[model samples]
Target: MQECDPDHLVLAIENGEFERASEILARDCQNRCVCSVSALQVTALQVAAWQGRIDLLDRLYEKGAGVNDVDKIGRCALYYAAHRGNVDVTEWLLQRGGYVDAKIGVYSCTKGIPYTSLTKACFVGRKLPLPVCWGRTPLHQAVKNNHADVVRALVEHGADVNAKDERLVTPLLLAGSATDRDDLKEMTKFVEIVKILVAAKAFVNIIHPDTGTTALHHAAMLGSAEATEILLSNGAWPMYKCKSSGSTPLHIVASTGSTETLMVLLEAMLPHNIDTRDQINRTALHRASYRGHRECVRALVEHGANLAATTKTGTTVVDAIFAHIPRPLAFITEILDSCVRTTNNSPLETYDNVLLAFGYLIVGFALSFAVLFHGNDQFRDFWRAVVRTVVMMMGEYEYEELFSAENGRGTFLPITSRIVFFAFIMLSSIVLINLMIGLAVNDIQGLEKEGHIRRLLKQAEFVAHLERVTSHRIFRGNWLHPRLRMLLHSRRDIPTKITLFSRENYFHHVNHLVESPSKIPADLVEALFLLATKTFHKNDNLTGKNIEIGDTKLTSILSNLEEQVRELKIHLSQFDESEIVETARIQNKACTKKTVNS
Candidate 1:
């Protein structure tokens, strides 16, 4: 090896010249040499670890190489080992007193590139060559490189799985967000890394301070179904809205058009949460429809997403989808068809109206044929008269056909026949036709009025179906959450004998009669109490008993509630000066006092 080239030993180890590397390190055992490679000044031990040569690594360590020696970028040999996915070297280094949670900072003043100033730049605006790997531990590097084995080894050696980089990204978040590449093997490795970290009790819900995104958010955005499932199964909350966009994981998955991932998320979500809106009051359905994600839209609709959900500005999902000019016909057709199916009754009802209209046509034909049969020879045969009336009703024949003498000698018809002909024309052409149109118009207007109610009914039907399916033996306890399963099977757990309510349950049952269950104005509370008191007094007079209000405990509770109502009235008067407020206040006071006296 050349003495002038300090990188000779490192290059020899990289090229599988382990014999030469061993000789160079053995001869220079008193001083371990460092080499400048790829703008990073790394020691020979770091090179051996990066190359995965345990023989050369052991030789360098025997020559008194520092286990925690950092390079120009502040990364140690263990960082390189983990970065290259060298599991054996990583394990050996850790066993030999290597720091497992060592953080690396890439900024240095020796590079002469405003290292301190650039480090202070925001992540969005920074235009540096290297990423901001400051504060990133060896585990972060391993997870970022998609090295599952290295990640496992580092984590086993007590690596900080939740350690964050300078950008506030943990190892789990980095692994979940590694979606720049589309390689299948890389994705598998990412899943493995995520599984290992989560198993080690990594914080799955750590939010990025800058972007307000968690590991679940990143996994949902990437559409990684396996990673998302693992995170959710490990207690990652799906309903936590991002602070920046105020969107949940469901919204992100829908916007990305990930149908499989969206299904996985839907399984973990509740029914009422399906239409949760973000900061702009836009639901996942709104995002999916706007992006023209047909499969996602179909899934959302089938899972009971509200088609009529609107934004704060009153824009609905339909309005967002149709806003595109030169409209997408297939997408528009899909949305319209879904809306009609969910919101309208069966078309069979409309068809019955049409059938009724056609029945009236037959009656008009019989009436005309009966009267005209005796006046004209054209109507002498029943079949011929039927054909003539049908043609005239369709406007295919001239009016002269009825009075002309060409077909079977009729200069003119009798007065009775003429009257029947005029009546048939009026009934068929004017009355029956307009009546059919009126029925269609009425049906359409009725659909509009009952559209919202039908949508709710469809959702209820879907819930009922889901409940029935989940109540089966196979899915009884294996599929749903424990709390939901308890709710579904609660009736089965009840005993044969009816039991009286406990003291707590009894108090809860009648608690609302004393005051409003939720926070509301004092006027409504007063009205409720007054109504209850009057009902009790009336029942006492009718039943000849004072069982409802005879107890001293009940009277004292009512009196205390009346006092609380008075205080609430005072609070309302301080902020509201409107006439309606004053009226409500006065009415509340009089009602409360009257109920107390009674």
Candidate 2:
């Protein structure tokens, strides 16, 4: 008998050349040479089973191949069979004492349930129960593949429907996320699967460990209206709060910008004031406004969302929108006007001036006693003398003349009396100035503290106001009309070259041209003309015009163009190759023109 090369046999099996592999195995019958099947080979057999080549797998098994052989990372044949929905292969291997408890692959710890071969085949509409080596049960595979038939089959076979993976994600959760059931035709099967799971008593409100989101939360997030309907009908609670964000399903819908999902959630009669907030105290309206979801904002408003809601930091939904949306001046003004008209027209005269004066008098009396009783008697005496002198001087001289030095001292008194009086007056003046300075300092500090508090309050109010206004305006702004028109208009002109440059620089260049169209320096004008020509002929070459420039200037222009191209490459990496080439050509032309005229 001929000897079989282990490598060639393994390759043949891997490539699905089962007949050739069988031939090689037959030829090496009498050599007493054994061929070891790698874990990859076992996986290949599972793939073959998926293709209905059961005969080939049988031959390989008869050739003394280890049914429980694992791959490099410890994944066995069962892992592949379960993953590919090969029920017959999985069942056969399991019956042959295949390791049904082996953990394989990255998420093995999370994939707790061991599915049977029958379950695996049922998942993808196959009718056979193939055995597998790894511990993942057929029910687990069904949920992973989102195959309703397999899931139903496994349930019939006594598979636990509520079993969770290492990540705590249940089979029901997986089915809801696997498919996009937007079209009615595609939704029927998934709807049936959900009904089956619900009938089997699967946990309808299972939350994921990482996101703390339930299956209902995921459905809302995906904008799958049909899935949402199915879940809700099957007793999936819409008000299930996400453990992480504390957001209800409606909040998730609003933030995801799923208009259909939002409408569905609203129609379900979920509590309008769910008021679920994220860690930062940002409500659904705050998220919708920040993301510029006009429809979501409108939905929230119609559902009685608090327009005056503020975040933990006192940022209102309006403030967040204004901070993000460009050219917010007109938008903000319009919002403020609307708010002013809607609010009550009561004047804020709550502070009574007479009461304030009385309070101040009481405070002054209290402060005087405290100072007199606390301080030294000598200091108190000095203060009293100063106050008396100030009052006496006021009585004798005109108040204005005392303050104004230019006024003459018209009334003459005894020389000794005047000296003593002047000395008293000087001492009183110094004390009065010092006291006034102290009061001024205190007033300034108080003002500064008050200003800080006012600024914070104003910021919070502004954010709230901006959020309210933007939310209202987003719905009323006729936004859909402009967007639809823009989308439908195919003849929209491309932006001009001048528009790409900074507005200030472009204005300066244009003004220079208008100021002295002819007197514009020949070289400078040539440079401008060259740039303009390149702009017009962006997709083509320019007409005849040659201007020689020095190497230094040419090098500078080339360097600038290179820098721009580098930046453009970074920004436009996702663009097609042809687009990148076209952009490069335009940049090169601009650089050449600038260099030639420089």
Candidate 3:
């Protein structure tokens, strides 16, 4: 085998000169040095196998090429053959001692994930389950690359259809979850692969232990109506919730805007399943509206969904739309000419006023008693003075007793007592009571005029909430750091909830690692809101044009109906004028005769 030049052999193989490629191999006994026959990274045998050059592969094998020869990673010749969809090459490779369970080259980096127990060193981390195969098998590569024939060949040769990768995603799940190019023909190919896997008895509801996605969930996510239908027909549970999001396939469909697939699921659903909520109590309607899927929202509503359904945080579908939909003022103002409205109907408003008045009355009474005690007092003690003071403040004082002049008592008290009492009367009884009255009256006057501003504030808060929900959804599905979501929401197990009212907590919640929730800088805020507003304006403009077209069609129909009504009235006039007049004349003559007799 060392007598054969590696460079010349590779050149012949590349140029597809199979005859010369085969002849370049030196005559070799069956027993030869193993490593010398193989090249550095990819052996010629593997290349020929991947290229589907069966004749060149046969020549290499006769020259002492090992069928089980692997690259630096554990990718065998069968792995390349399987990935390339060359079933005949895969069969030849496997028949010559290729192991089905050999790991593929794709996961070469993830091999031998050591079980480093930090718990043994300190006590924090955990013992993660390292996959023994380190990840992909030949079958996984075949299914991932859409080599359906290779998939069949391996499965028939006793490959594990249920083999799990590092994330516990199986070959069957991988097939359904192939990154869609959005081509219809590619979609059909995936559907066929799913059918093949299902015929092999692949488990339909095996959740990826990491992502918690099932085969059905993956198919739903793919948005292929036919693939979803096939999975459902094969006992895929549509209601199985993913552990990560606690969302069923129905929620996935609504979120993905897969209306056709949604219809397929809905037609097979029981009536009670229509309003199923996810973990956050967001119904499919809420999902559709939050994402601005107008048609999906309409379909959900037409199916008798509860439009007023609330999330766990107490927001309804209409609320979601109002809060999140950009340019909501224009849309809402059309139906509500006032744009926004508020109602201050709480009973507490009046109760607050009453409390304010009572508090001032107590303060006034206390001051009057304290002043009366500073000098001469008509009463025996401070308590007596306080009683008298209360009476004087309410305008029910006994004026005759203070001025009686009985037993050396004069018509007036000393100057100090008189001045103190009079000042108390002015400060407490007059000034303080009037102040409370003014405040109460002011509130009443303002409520009537401030409704519009209150409404605007309410609309702003609604829009902000919409922005928050949309951003949260994006982070959950975005390719960014999703762990940042923990800051937005409090965890039950964490102590963040304890500081809910603390200043530092409020500051951090609004300002830490993010723009302030309410007061982002104007330019940045505009940029953030611009995308939402543009989508809204585009959609609203389209909607307006559609409405105009419908209005034109409606006008033509109304004109036709008006002409028909006019023609029908003319026909009725021609039939009954003479007969109607004669009847009226007879009735008038009878009435005049009866009146004269009476």
Candidate 4:
């Protein structure tokens, strides 16, 4: 009839005193509830499970210890068993109807027991609140600890392979997570675990709730070629984009500069996705170039990644490379030179034409000056006239010399000849010289504008080049299947339809295409406008109509629910606070009586 503390049973189990623990449980089974926990808030069953004492676990369970009773952290006995890799204890708990997929913070005591009264039960039914356990299942703990046997046991017992934690990360994602230390044995163990989970049909593409990354994303970030190959082989989508980073596995691997893992992912990646952009609108090649991963950039280029692809800020791959390494090595320069020549139309060529035009103007002026000053001895010879023209062009020749008799330049010249001199000076010095300078200045100003266009052209050229390569006879049998390859390589004459919801949406897209810092083609702008105009109705027609926010059915349902809430609030307002509390108290008593009767 005396009271006994739960710590006595917990200590008995901890000390491996099976007889004393059983005696306490047998006596406490009638006098006290085994669910009563110690100062640490851990039940005796949880201690026995953690200690892998199958005998004590059975005794505590038979004496009214809930198989799924939780500790302070809401971890149940099975969770501790799985955490400790106690296979026998886990199997015993599972046999006793323990929930295998029980998460850390969930209490299963009142689960599936509708008639059970919380007031009659012990601590577990109290609903003691705790923080998030990341929704981790017993399987997550087993996988995290690398207990392959326990993982197998949990899976064999119907553990949820796709059970996600609070982060929306699946057990498979946790198993494939990267670590800072690259222990071969540790990685090998995880790879085996991944194999087992995949064999059990785990969803490989489950995205992280926050990061929107999958198992492949983490594996790529890990730079593990073996793990990447396994995931890719098991239907992992290589081009699956992350919502947070908007990066594909290829993009993730590129940032790490793992050429081997990149190659593995690239093998699984579609050719069109090789230049896929991330959240910042930069491709894997851009990421590689920015990180100064020369080998990664080289590999990507060989795989047909676009070197001309620009970031959202108008930074080309070459620009990124130069920004990271101001002066790169010879091979990087060579690679750049080859692609730059193919894409870039240098201003130097136009400058050469301007220089040639200037030369012709000088020669033409010299011939005219020679004819105009023929009567003067100084300009009698054509070559001598050329020398004078050069000096005059430099602003060194004096106008007094042209009119002075002692200089013998133009003292005896006719009025027509003097007029010719004035015309020549104005045309050659002011008009022609300034025109040349103006052309050079205009070219410099056009460079920035031309850069955006040049990138577009280069991208076009790259696509065309890829089309030609893919369609080549050499790649006929060696590359993709004939039909799939033809489908991908075939040119489309018809444009795809794009829907613009509103006038703002339409203008936003048009402005995006026409923005000064990164201008696309005018034809592209025109095409977008034409497509929108033909596909959707005019804004004028849509002006008076109210835009729907959500699904009409959902909106109607929500409105009905709001009406119900208002009615409930009005009905509740009829009763005073004390009356409502008394009603709840009576209902609780009735439920407790029913539980006691059951």
Candidate 5:
């Protein structure tokens, strides 16, 4: 028998000449095993399954062909079966211990599940179990693909209906992106899946990790009216705000151009003031107007979106929207005409009036000062009076008239008086200026002291918030970074670097400093200090401590610092004398102790 080449084998598989390929495998290639069977044979089985050749699949499976074998792309027969919706072939492969969760190609491993494949099939109106890769489960793929039967099968087979993918998007969230009728029909299956998940007590309002979007938020964002309706009917709360971005479902809907989705969201009983701003102080109205979403803008206006709302830069939504328009004046006029007519003071006009008043006051004061002391005679007289007052205040009046009679008669008297008066004027001016500057310095010092006290109070409040967040035992020794933990437990004597304080005695001493602070509330810091001290004490070398300082700990520490700073700003509002003194005393003592130790 003549040996079959790789090209012939592949051609036979592609042309569906399975009988001829089998004859070649049994006769000419019976004693010869080609590695191409693992690759080419898998492709043949996939093609057979795609062409509905059940007999071909069975014969190949019986020919000692590798069921779980992968091609160059790592896609196996089972991956093809599941992907192609060949239930019989998929079942057969699964029964043969082929990994259902087997990763496909390297590209699939990184790019995540084949959503495009499933979605395209769904668009063409095919019903098959959705294929998944990466962290996405079949349920998520089915919902994303919008395949009703596939979604149903996946859910029935115990696929996690509420399971989040790498982006933390659940199956319900994926279904919300469906736009076409085929996509919507498939999305209907997600409605049932959502119900199942809700019944299972999955968090319906849980936020996604990436965008911090909830299922309701996703539904609102994608303009999925039916999905939004289903979610509401199944007790999904639309008012639930994302924890990270702090955007509610209404905000998402109002920011979108989808009139139907917006209507569905608006009809749902959301919380009052649902169009709240996020960290950037942008309302839903701002987004709608900026995007030129006329319907969304109108909906927002009808729902009492504040037209006069301004961002941090003091630009009103109307101002921003008008500024971005190509024909600004016309659009501005149209929008202003639609606005509810009311009498209110113009902010810009008020600002101009205030600036004018300030300018007038400054010019008036300068002119009045210049006019009052224009003549040298009057100036001399004024300086003499000032000098006399200063001399009297200092008990040196005897020296005040030392130059009063330096020359004889009126001729010399005028010259002597002028010289003495000018000297007195210069001296008095210097003294008065120093006095005024001293008063100003005192005022500034008082303000600085107040600010410092406020900052301390803020630090205390931040420590309180940190204490609240790390109260759980599971979070113990896990939430703070090593540097932050070291900073929190930092002693006056130890350097900032861990390597510098890696010495057992120094580490123990620093631990004492942290423990000495009665107000330090972070358990992670305390735990880290305790563990590090104990570990280092037992073995003077600081090996393996690096592993203890995980990235999560660092992230938590940074979060605490930010939260503390914010709290300190709030604390600045309530400054007190006693609190300031106590804080100063503690800080001073800490400094003194550190200096002595160092």
Candidate 6:
């Protein structure tokens, strides 16, 4: 028998040549082994599946064509058919004893069956030479592409709606992935598909293997209020923080400034969740203020969000914004104002009081000088009286003037007059001067106690500026002319390369902008990947105390050290009297005792 080219038969099948496909299959030259000759899995049945050719599919199967054959990526003919939304062909294959969960060549030794159980345990997570399908069923493909009819057909044929792929991603979880929801329309389709899956009793809270994110997390990240509401109504727990982004649904909307979606999540979370913080101790209000979402800040404030909420650095939202915006948004004026109300004995207030005291001191000096100079002949000039009083206040007034007067003025001066003059000196030089010093010292002490709050307010103002500008670029501008790039140029908070817009306008030319890696530099990419995974451990000169090079645990350690220092400072601040001298004496005695013992 002449050898038959499987490519020709595949081409015939792809082009809808049912008779030619039948003729080629009937000849004994073609068989299941012959399908492997092509570069990809393009056997007669695989091509029929790709084109949804049910007639060619029936003939090929009858003539010994493999039904569950998979292509290069562990995807079978059933996968191809389901991916293409071929409901009839998928139904036909299902009825003809085809496996609904067929992965490419499952029974082959390449599937890792020959390994011992020990070896299996070791390499279960590691990939093999020929990878088995992540265990995704045909239903996974149908749900992914928004083919409701195909999904319904696959489900009715006993396909597992909750089938876990190798990554532990379920069909329902895959349905909610953001890779498909690129726009509002696409997001709506995903909601419809998810509704179908939920109707089929698909588990909603499956923690995905790659990110530990649940279905609600994905829906929230996708910015779909309807999908989020649907999941939440279906008893989906929205509180679980995704380990990948370190965020819940609330954090997602807050970061993106999705005001409407934010309202949806906020309504669901309600009174118990306004100040809920993430891994970094950043609340939704913190995220909103950091991004400058005034409307979100307003809503949170209305719900009585803790305006004093702090991040890991103990910085309030008002402080976070002061560095970014010249002035905070008008909506967050209340939060900014709370900066004055929140802190006690702040340095800024103390500095202001000290200035006011100096201003009042000038008036007091003028009045006292005019009164003392009133019944004297030579000291009648206001300027001369001011000069003499300033010298007397310093205890530098000359007594020689009373003893040697050229006009015989000292001979008639009374002793009782001297007593009255000395009384004025006591009040001006001793009493009021000491009182001024005491008040300034008191203000300085108050500043030492609460200076951190002023800085926090400044930081809050900086980040709040960013949030407001970002919201404006999205919500304020004309929809036909979305000024997305304006955010990058508006403030230096977000970098120039980053973008927040979900879609680009039709006329906007997105030049050589690499949205994704079209051509990956494999060696460099692999080297980078290895650099991240490679262990960087050594315990040499540091006395066997090691630290991960890129680990963030050091931040916590530093923060704890800062807190300890703060407590020590506070404890030491109370030692302002004779106790400090006593503490020094005790230290000296202890040193003497240690010296004697040595």
Write down the lDDT of every candidate, Cα atoms only.
0.72, 0.57, 0.65, 0.72, 0.55, 0.64
Encode model 4's per-residue lDDT on 1-598: one tens digit a residue: 3335565666667666777777776776463536555323567778788878887776666767888877645788888887777888888988889899987754434343333333222333122223335588999887877777888888999999988777776788777453442787777767778888988999987877777888888788878888888889999999989888788888889999889999998888778889888888899999888888888988888778887898889999877875774344444656656565343435686678767876786788777767766766667887887787888888866777666667564444458667867777887779878877876787777887788899999999998788656544455464677777667545622323322222344334334222323344445545544433443232563433312312343456456657766775575467665775676678779999999999
What is the lDDT for 126 in model 6?
A: 20
Evaluated against the true structure, the overall lDDT of model 6 is 0.64
Error of 6 at 391 (Å): 85
Residue 407, candidate 4: alpha-carbon lDDT: 57
Give the alpha carbon lDDT tens digit for every residue of 1-598 in model 1.
2542446666666666778777777677345454333335556787678778888777666667788987656778888788777898999999999999988876454464345433432131111123356888889888877889999888888888888788888888777455553677877887788899999999988988878888888888878899999999999999889999899999999999989999999999898899999999999999988787878887898788887899999998777765631234445566567666433545566668667766666656755664555456656666666777777767654657665556334533457666766777787788877877886787777878789789999999997777646545565656778887787778334322211222444335334232324444445444444544553343333443444333543566567767766775574455433655566678779999999999
Worst 10 residues of 6 by lDDT: 494-503
RMSD (CA, Å), each prediction: 26.2, 24.2, 29.8, 31.3, 27.6, 28.8
Cα lDDT tens digits, model 3, 534-585, are 4222245366764554466456655665776677557445545466567667
- Per-residue C-alpha lDDT of model 5 across residues 360-436, encoded as one tens digit per residue: 53344333322332332322354453444444334453433333344222122455445544544554455544654
Better of 1 and 6 by TM-score: 1
In angstroms, how far off is 161's CA in candidate 3?
1.1
Give the Cα error of residue 235 in candidate 1, in Å.
1.6
Candidates 2 and 4 compared by TM-score, better number: 4
Model 5 TM-score, all chains together: 0.40
What tens digits encode model 2's per-residue C-alpha lDDT throughout 1-598?
3227554555565566778767776786642223433322233344444454667667766766666765443555554555565666666766676655454444323133234322332222122233332334445665666566545555655566787555666767766555664655435556666677777888888877877888888777767777788778767777777778788788788778988888887777556554567778888878877887766776676666676788889998778665654334444454445444332222222124333543454344333322432242322454553443335534443335432335223323335434544554554455544554665666567668779999999999997776544433344356558765454332332322221122344334334222322333434544544543442221122112112223334456666767766775564455555765676678779999999999
lDDT of 6 by residue, 1-598 (tens): 3324565566556566767766766774446424543333346676677778887777767767788766545666788777787888888888887788764434333343334432423322121123334677778777767676788888777777888777677888777543554666667668877787887888988888878788887777777788788888888877778887678878877776767777777777768777778888898878877787777776777667787788898988777655433345433565556545444555566667755764465346545545543445545666766666666667865555633456334334445445546665776677767776776787777676556778888889988876645544344456633455554445444321211222334113221221322343444444444544555464364323334423444455446657766775675466565765676678779999999999
Give me the runs in candidate 4 sitting further than 4 Å from their true place. Answer: 1-4, 11-33, 38-41, 53-66, 71-74, 85-88, 95-97, 104-131, 144-146, 164-169, 325-327, 333-598
- Residue pairs with colliding backbones in model 3 are none
RMSD of 4: 31.3
